[model samples]
Structures are given as C-alpha cells and as structure tokens.
Target: MSRGAWRDRGAWLLAFMHAFVAVCVLLPSAGVHAAETVHAQIAATSEQVAALTAVLEARLEPLVLEVTAVEAVDPAAALSAPPTEDVARVWITLDDGGATAIVLSGDGARGMVRQLPREGASDEVLREELALVIGTAVDTLRRDAASLASSAALREELGLSPEPEPPPEPAPSVEPPPPAPPEPSPIASLPPLPPVVRTPPPVEPTRWRLAGMAFYEVQGFAAGQIIAHGPGLSLGLGGPPLTLGPRFELSGQYRLPAAAENDVAGLRLHSGAFRLTTQLTVVRSSRVLLRVLGGAGLDLLVIEPFLVDARAELMPRRVRIAPALRFGLDVPVRLAGEVSLRIGAGMDVDAIGTRYVIQDGDALVPLLDPLRIRPLLSLGVDTTFVGHPAFGP
Candidate 1:
C-alpha cells in the first residue's frame, strides 16, 4: 500500500465502520441472503459527498461552499457562473454494481463523467481513487471563491432572496378632532379630556446588518466624569433575518479616554470591550426595524499617567480585565440600496475594581475601589449583506 493510503487507513476504517452502521439502519434488507444493490449505491454516494464536503469546508468556508438537495436545485442552475455566483453545481452518482461517477459538467470544467471504485471500498483504497476523481473540481471551486471574495455581487447567491420592492407611500395621517368645550352651566364638568392618538407599531428589518459607529459617553459613573468619545462597530450575524427570531451578534467598542476623577492619581484611563450578543426582532415594517438585545463579554481598561518631569517618566503602566454585561436597542431606517441610518443605544456594566493610581516620584502606586455602570449612545450607518463571506477578496 502507498504511504498516503497507509496514513488514512485508521481514520478511513473508523469512518467506514460508522458509515456501515448508518447505511444498514437506513437500508433495510429485502431478504436475509442479500441486500439491494441500489441501496448500497445510495450509501456509497452519500459517503463520497460527505468526504467532499468535509475537505471543502476545512480548506475554504461554509459561505464558499453550499450543500443543497437535488429537488431544491433549479434545472437552469448549471448555466449560472460560479465565480460570480453564490453556489456552484457538480454531480456525483453511484452505479448499480461496482462503479461510481463524478460529473463536473457545470462548474467551469469540461463536461465529462469520470468513473471510480464501487461502494463498500475501503477508505485507504477509496482515498487514492477519489482524489483522482474530484481533485480538479475542488481546485476550480477554490479558484472561484478567491476570485469573487470582494466583488460587488448580490447576496442572493447564498440562498438569500432579494428584498421585495417597496410599496408606494401611504396617505398623510389625519389629525384627531379637538376636544369639546367644558359645560357653561354651574356644574358637573371637570376639564374636557383630550383626544387620543394611536401610534403605529415598530417595523421589523429584514436582512443582515453591518454597522460602524462613534460613541458619545453619555454617562460613566465609575470614572465620575464624562468619558471622552470613542469608536465602535456591530455585526448582525444571527442566522437569518426572519421575523421575531433570535440572532447572534459580535460587537465592540473602544473609548480612548476615561479620564480619572480629580486627577488624584495623576493618571487617566482608556477602555475597550468586546461582546457576543443576541438580538430579537420586535417589529419590522416598511422602512423601519426594531430589535432588543443582550450580550456579555470581556472589558479591558488601561491606566496611563501624565509624566512631566523633564524626562517625564510615568511608571507602572497598568491594565485590567472585567466581566461586562450589555443590553440595548438597534433601530435602523432603510435608505437606498443596502444602507440604513441607525440610532442605537446600550447600557453596559462592568465588574471591576476601580484601582486608583497616584504618582510617588517616578513610581506609580494604586489603591483599589469599586466601579460603576456606563451608558453608551451612538449614531451610525448600517448595511445589509448579500451573504458576505467572513473572509473576502
């Protein structure tokens, strides 16, 4: 046996044994003597597909490769350009007896079906055989992904549907009638009640959103003074943009200056935090979206002192990490294309000791104290993606 085959023997044996049990459970016997050949062929095809999928995902990414059911695929999909498209099509088939075929007709390669060893073949043997079978097709897919990483393509390629065209604007809202005058006679009348107006519910937003922002430190209780502004960003990475669904988010903020109170330590502070959060859609409608979110992650603070003694030496540059919890709102209004205007807010609290830093000559000393919760306010632009792969050209 070759070195490559020998190396894969253990993993192949283990996977093959598991595959055998799965195949047996899925493919019942017609008779005690012999199992159906087509069932075995189906099992064979499944194993090969699984192998291909594993390799591709490890080398490329889930966004770069998509697995689909035969029925879900359109007959015309073969004509779409994979390099510029979200998905590519290739075929794998197993024959009734001792043969298998790999068809690379659609994804920018020659339209030919190549044969390989039959089902139940050992992994050691199949590895060598299958490499020759699908190697070129894998290469083609890798090239396509690399070429289109940063292209201005629509998000529909990743199985996402385009947003429907917007409806025409609604008629202007009518004002409620004014309240009637109070009774002139000696009596029975308190001040007339004002007319009531019912407001519309918040709208839900469809599609993934990406945003970059600048923060205004509305309140920083621990620092005792208003923190100077900072920079932040958010990503709507939850699975899909469906209604009332829970979505995952990865977000971050960096406040460049969290100036210490009273300058007691002759030191100032800089803080940054990273979080993974979930946002649940409360409403989505024409031109508006509302979501409520909560998240927890790492908060980092750096203490730097003002060193101004000719050489201006400040000692003991210190840093600390705290557990942070955040809850917030993300409301965005639709603009042209995939862009939106965002007005968002959050409450962030960190569990950290507010250690005071003071200068004793060139050495900096510290005294431990408690910290407080911070409120963050931001205004920024957000954009929806057509399944932007995490890594792109």
Candidate 2:
C-alpha cells in the first residue's frame, strides 16, 4: 500500500536471507570442530581409574579429550592397528615391586613407557606424574604428525617432485688386459706339513649360589581367649638358585617367651622351630625377587604356669612337640650389591593341639588351650655368595 511500507518489507527480507546463509556456512565447520575430540582409552586398577582420568584431563589442556575406562589396554594390539588422529590408549600396571604406565599413540607407529615409583609418594602425586608423562607423549606424537602433514603440504605447494635416481653409472667397461709373466717356484719342495689337531677346552658346569638370611619376625597365636604375640629371630641357609625348578632352604627360628595372664592364672610360653622349605620364584628382576614358599616344620613349645595364690605351688614347666605345615610368600628388594631387604608373610597349622590344665582343688581347670593356627610376619636381609667349582682333573 504505501512506499515506506514496501521499502521496509524488502530490507527485512534481505536481512533474513543473509542471516540464513551465514548460519548454513557456520554449522558444518562447528560440527567438524566438535567431532575432532581425542578419544583416550585408559586401563587401570579400579582404585586408580578416577584419579588418573581426572589428572589426564587437567594435563592435556586445550585439546578436547574424551576418556573411557576399560578393563584392559594392550599396547601391542593398539600398535598393530592403523593409527588415527583421534584415538589413544593408556595402561597402568602395578605390582609389589613397582608401577609402570604404557601409552600408545593413535598412530600405531609410536608408543611410550614410563616407570613410576611405588613408594613414598601420595596417590595424587603419582597420578599427576603419570598424567604428565602421558600428556608429553601424546603431544610429541601429535606434533610429529602435524610437522609431517605440513611438510607434505609445503612440498605439494612448491610443486616439487622426488629426485630421479641417477641412471646407475653405466658399469665401467671391464677392459681385457694383457697376461703377465709367471714367477719361479720355490727350490726343493718341502715334505707335506702334518695335519694339525685341535682340542676344545673342557666346559664348566653352572656354579651354585649360597644364600644366608637373618630375619626378625613377629608371631601371633591364639591362646585361650586372648591372642599371644612374640618376637622371634631366624637364621636361614638357602641352596643354589635353580633355573627350572624350585630352590631349597633350611631355617631355624627361636621365639622369645611371651605371657598371657588371666584372672585365675597366668601362663608363659615360648617355642623353637626348624623348617625346610622349597621356594619357587615367581617374579625375578633386577630390582626385586618374589617367591612362593611352602614347607613343614617341627616346633618345640615350652610352657610355664603360675597360680595367683602365694601359697599355691608353682606348676612344673611342660614341653610339647608339634609338627606344623606352613605356606608363605616373600619378596626381596635389592638394596645393594649381593644384599637385599626381605619381607615375608606366612601361616602355620599345627597338627596337634596341646591343652594345658591346672589342678584347682581336684577339679582340673584349663589354663591355656592349644593354638591350632599361627600367623607370622618377617623382615630381614639376605646375602648371596656364589660358590666356585670344586677342584678336579
């Protein structure tokens, strides 16, 4: 109807068309940017999963990273697969001796391994250290990839081609040369030389290793209604280190006397044990050695009893013999040359339960009951000496 109205309507339509065109142009690029996220697959213990993921997120800043927890991550498997820009895998493994983290790049061609400390540091600190290592590896891989891509792009832009291999220099023409004159032979041919006979030196057998260990241990046993604890000392001698079979060891242990008292009566008990065990090495490395041991032992227990009443006569001490079966695990961490710090835990089951009774006005009352099971923990040092072969012809 009016000229001003018509002009206003045309301007509004033009603005709408331009806005629509701009939105269409921006949407695809935004989607592409959002899709370019780095997918991180993490394999770690259940306790460490959350902390590791959080630390990684913090360290890999500016790059969009999506972390997923998995049961396991195999670096070899990751390396075998074709690498992509958006995927990475990390694995954290822990043992009694130490910890380690392995990182595999999205490009199957690269990977990194980091050894982490197993002690002294807080969990947060360790996780941060791991994250830092993984971040560095990923960044290095991406930077290399970017550099390669940029180099390729530059080469294409410059329209450069690979230099053609120089035609293998035409093999030099081997010209035929004139024959030379022969020289004179030696005078009076000597008798043919005698055939030489060679003999190999005798091979030496693998030498045996002798190991000695001195240990301090704490032992726990249930006596009556209370648990009795005592300190013990042990000296052990171990046989050769066997490659295909378990090694053998013989140890003697003596436990100091410990007393458990009750309102009615008190008792003091001590024991000595001799054990012969077979040790099968499970994990052996430069830093640590782990072994599982099992064996049987003979125990001599001495018990002394006293009555609260001053007039009551002191009961004579009694000696009991017990056969015990034991199973244990030990780890020795190398501290210096030929010496290591050893820690062990074990359980012993007694074959015979000895019950002690006190005479109380013709009615025998149980003063102490037999301990059927005992638990032991030990700490000590181990030293090894390699023996030389015996002198023989």
Extract clashing residue pairs from model 2.
none
- The models' CA-based lDDT, in order, is 0.54, 0.68
Error of 2 at 190 (Å): 27
Per-residue lDDT over 250-333 for candidate 1, one digit per residue giving the tens place of the 0 to 100 score: 767777775543333356777777889887878776677788989899877787766434454456778978787888998867
Q: Which candidate number would show the highest lDDT if scored against the true structure? A: 2
Q: Candidate 1, TM-score vs. the true structure?
A: 0.39
RMSD, every candidate, angstroms: 46.9, 42.9
Candidate 2 at 63: error in angstroms? Answer: 99
Taking the tens digit of each residue's C-alpha lDDT, what string does model 2 give over 1-393?
999999999999999999999999999766644544456666666667777677777887666667677776554444344556564555565434355665555654445666787687777777777777878877776666343233223324335553344587787888789777876668548787899998899865455656778887766676435444443444444433434236677877777776765556778887877788888777767777788999998988888887776766687888888898889998888887777888999888877775777677889887766577778888888776554211111
Error of 1 at 343 (Å): 1.3
- Backbone clashes in candidate 1 total 10
